[model samples]
Target: MVNECAPKPHVALLASPGMGHITPLYELAVRLVTQHNFQVTFLVITAGSTVAQDSYLTAYPIPDLHIVDLPPPDMSNELLNNMKTVARLCYIVEQSIRPLRSVLNGLKRPKVKALIIDMFCTGVFEACKDLSIPVYSFFTASAALLTFSLYLPTLDCKADGEYVDLPEPVKVPGCNPIQTQDLMYLVPKSMINEYQQWFMHVSRLPMVTGIFVNSWEDLESVSLKAVKHEPFFANIPTPRVYPIGPLTKQAEPVLTKYEKETIAWLDKQPKDSVLFVALGSGGTLTSEQLTELAWGLELSQQRFVLVVRKPSDCAISGFFSAGSDVDDPIAYLPDGFVERSKGVGLVVSGWAPQVGVLSHPSTGAFLSHCGWNSTVESVKYGVPIIAWPLFAEQGINAALLSNEVGVAMRMPMVGEGGEAVVVRRKKIESVVKAVMEGEEGKKLRRRAKELQASGRETLSRGGSSYETLARVAESWNIET
Candidate 1:
């Protein structure tokens, strides 16, 4: 129990840009406040912030949680536009150091005891170097990815050149072997050295006080075990690893007219009948891929709700343009595709209420980009996946879901040397048909439900995540 006589220990959570990063940190902050009796200040690094980010935060409010947006640095759009996503995220964090330190120094009321940072914002550690407070890393992805990352430094020394060119799959003990193309955080060839150096710097465990991964023991026991117990890591100076999640936001009641209408349509569908296709907030496909997906859905003759984005060659083309003005994605669909599949499908042009849609009874399967947030949400709602991973750690996540967890069937990318990166319409149709009608779909559904139940169990009172967070909370109190 919290010591009622003592003041609540204060903590600060730093979130990087993107809904994938912000959502989990926000949810984790809420849990710390409500369940662990800690006061939390949520610090958002406001570089390239999105409208969806603003709307999501405003939707959920808690009295104990104080939200702060760090001043955006005066970086030109042209400069930011030229850099890739990872480079941009890193640059933003680097620029925020001064303002971040000022925010830390200014918080005097029940002075902050610990600061937890998003994985990308590790550069801000420079700001905290002189402070007495401890800094923790909140890894918002799976433990499997975490294992792979921590093992990268070793892989770097042994491998000759680019990881993408490795002839065989990369192996981490006790985890699924990762294919070369499926590697997380692989940058362009020109930036490989910089990227490797950056990851090597972060992999050294003594840098942070601990790690808070958005995963549970039941979801990733083997990878979690490898992080803690593997002989390979015994020599490394590892930080405390806390698997304290499935920390995803629950669907609030629908307020927007579009959301209400979407939910209403879902309500009318048969149970486990409609396929929900969304490629997260940032994922987009090439026009060719988009056309193939449309025709595939039409051919399957199955019910679907597809959230379409303006097609681009870059998979993450929608990253900075999430809620920005542009042409409707529906206009880009194959000719007569929407009209022909009108009753059987609903094509939302921009964003969809993912949590609400996944929770709906008719959402039997999800065709997702397999972003970690989307992955955890689908698992929480017991929705099997058609794992169509685009970039970042998504490919790793897809491997985990389809290979290790058995909760998803991966969509294969067919091409020579990654030149042709599209899955043809026939393959898309077959996967959709299998997921909706084949025996494999039944198996995936069963596994999804099993993981869903395990997720709930791990978050309940006296459960693994609950106990871990409680212990961490008590430690912060003691440190203060």
Candidate 2:
């Protein structure tokens, strides 16, 4: 009898044209090639292509790895402008599918067996359908977002002007009832309609085999179950939805050069005394907001490190000032605020290694914008949070942390000129002080510690996420 088990299949990944999307896909690609021996080819285009190529070459230079370039599209500029144009970019993305198909048809090797695609790149599945390549959709957002995306049509039906008032709680397949407010509303109304159409068309593609999320099962078990039970998704063979994250596992243990400096500063501070504040790379704060935050941190009299990014609005002076030029953010901060609270604060502007800062022993609490990646990282390190969600699904995640999980507190915001604005300086000061030294803060901190332990146990040898990853690798006949 001849042995029938086949060699690992060649896999191609089509990532969204941004660092946020490309980085995680690259990490997964590295794991696929390094540990599983899959022949991997990554498709790249435009400026982000250069970054993808550089990262891949530095991380994995094996002969089996390949990079294919696609023609740059005009809409690439718009894609980078804002989240609002995402739906318009889809038309441009659809055009690339044919070119990608031609490239894949010409590949000569272990043979292209599977396609791992970013959730936004639904065009790939339509183009590759006849080739019988199994395409898996990877969602970087939480399962709740996916659930919301799937039910948008229903929400559209119930919309009133400017807001959709959902009754009690809307139940989504495979997940618990979610409040209407939890859904991400960053996309414009017109774009939401277009995206809904796009999703409907793409979900019917025959080649789509599964959905993979960058989350851990333990963290999102309820949402995962809800996703599995959807009727529309029933006919489409639901590919194994695995929560393989916090993707930071593969990042080298050695801290980045900048991180080393931040850590060194942290070392001199008392244990659990610093309040670490940062937003994701894309987050920006107005000068007014910046001044308020500075005063708040100073008022708390807590040792702190704040990574402040440039403001997005052009009207603001020093809007894009790299913090390197100034000794203190307080120079731009409100007058006399720094003098009043001299010893309690330190501000590091622009980029800082957020994970490194959060993991430091002196770091007792986090004031964050509540991006999912940051949320998971904070939980992993047992850092309690003061959730000040800026946009996207961040508000949803913040709600879960503050209300459902009891691991975080929400900083109140007020609606101004149709947009939700952060609370005033006095409110900011009170909240910061409460999170840093109050009994409520202590309870949240304890809960965060428990959540952190759960994450560790889940990522350990036999944890749910660990097993899910193992099964996913095995299903592809790739060695774990």
Candidate 3:
């Protein structure tokens, strides 16, 4: 195709089985191919019976971006349910090495320059090393989480015992203070036993030539400085860190048949008036919590679109498949909730057209689960958040967004024993009103807008994110 002129550098991007990981990688690939002129091949690990991959490809098909699927691990349903997700994913990736090696050996033209892998897929690091291919770790989390991962090695979790029971706020060198409850509430006990395995993975981080994060400098300058300058990290000989992010989805993402109806409904709402609610893929609430959320939105007197998930479904079971046209979510809702707020709210069960809703002219605020992707999207659109964290790194993000970033208001959650507690309807109404109308809401809005402008600026030509990718491109040249 190039007439033996300028050969395109081929780079492989490896994504594990989750929307949280794949979405950012998808954004990064788009920029790399269209903006930087690299040929990207995605080596995707097959997920269990989820529709995430199929939906993403169907919704946003970049034919220029080649894909090769690695075989799914033959995990037994019973064992798979009990095993920690990270452990299972990492183990599955290890099993796929034979096939991956065969594929790599069969390569002809456009040789792979580097393998950029999700942090969870650390098995590929060694394979790349043996094959003389450049390898990079991609952190899909916030800079704060990445910093924590680097610092985790230094802290003695074994001596301290369980994550939540730690006496004081766990402090990472040069980074923000993290409370035990906020930081470790969702960490599985299996992670403690697997610390040796985790260390084996992260210890390999510095061995790579570079580490790519889905974040930008302006967004987390303080945390970033800690990551780069902290004396604790100095002992490790860390990789060249690249904060080449804000790679969140653009507003108005490609539409699916499911989204068409949602978009049409949104079209009728007034400008800067509707509140969009959806917890990111892994978030779910108990039946009681749902009732409060419904009452809260109704009492706020705000126009809204809520993406409700089926309570019986597996957590982390979403990528592109949320709700299709076949399911009606109304059955599970609170009694008379829909009839009481007919025109005022549109409640749909399943996945929502998130970016489309975020980018709409009528969208005023986002009530999010505080997942990094949702956080980035809200930040990208200048929409203030009602930070409602349920699990994983969401608590860290909620702390960052509400306390550090000033772009959101944190919800007061009282969950315990893996059961969702009822957040009072009054608390919900207050937070909703605060973002939808009050002066405090206005302030949050202004800050979010400021972040939005900076986020976009960094992606523009000659901007920081743009230049950061330049370094990544240059790294590709070293091997080619």
Evaluated with lDDT, which candidate comes out highest?
1
State in Å the error of residue 204, model 2: 6.3
Residue pairs clashing, model 2: 173-226, 174-225, 174-226, 174-227, 175-226
> For each candidate, what TM-score against the reference?
0.95, 0.81, 0.92
Worst 10 residues of 3 by lDDT: 317-326
**Better TM-score candidate (1, 3):** 1
The per-model lDDT (C-alpha) reads 0.84, 0.66, 0.77
lDDT of 2 at 135: 81
What's the candidate order when arranged by decreasing lDDT?
A: 1, 3, 2
The local distance difference test score of model 1 is 0.84
The residue-by-residue lDDT of candidate 3 on 363-383, one tens digit each, is: 989998889988998898889
Give the CA lDDT, 0 to 100, for residue 452 in model 3: 94
Pairs that collide, model 3: 322-350, 322-351, 323-350, 323-351
Off by over 4 Å in 2: 1-8, 48-71, 74-98, 106-108, 158-177, 190-207, 229-240, 249-260, 313-332, 335-343, 415-419, 478-480
Number of colliding residue pairs in each model: 0, 5, 4
Give the total clashing residue pairs for model 1: 0
Candidate 1 lDDT by residue in tens digits, 59-106: 868887988888878888898888877777777777765587788888
Q: For residues 1-480, write the lDDT of model 2, one tens digit per residue.
A: 534465556788887654446656766776677656676888764433332234433564556667776766555555544433344445545655657767888877666767888766877665687777778877776766666665655555666433324445666555666655554344535456555645564354334577767776556666776667666555444455667776542332333454566677888999888988887645667777878788777766788887765554421122122223223454566788646654566666565667677888899999988877678778889999998876667777786778767888888763533346756778888888888889998998988888788888876768776677667666765422
Ranking according to TM-score, highest score first: 1, 3, 2
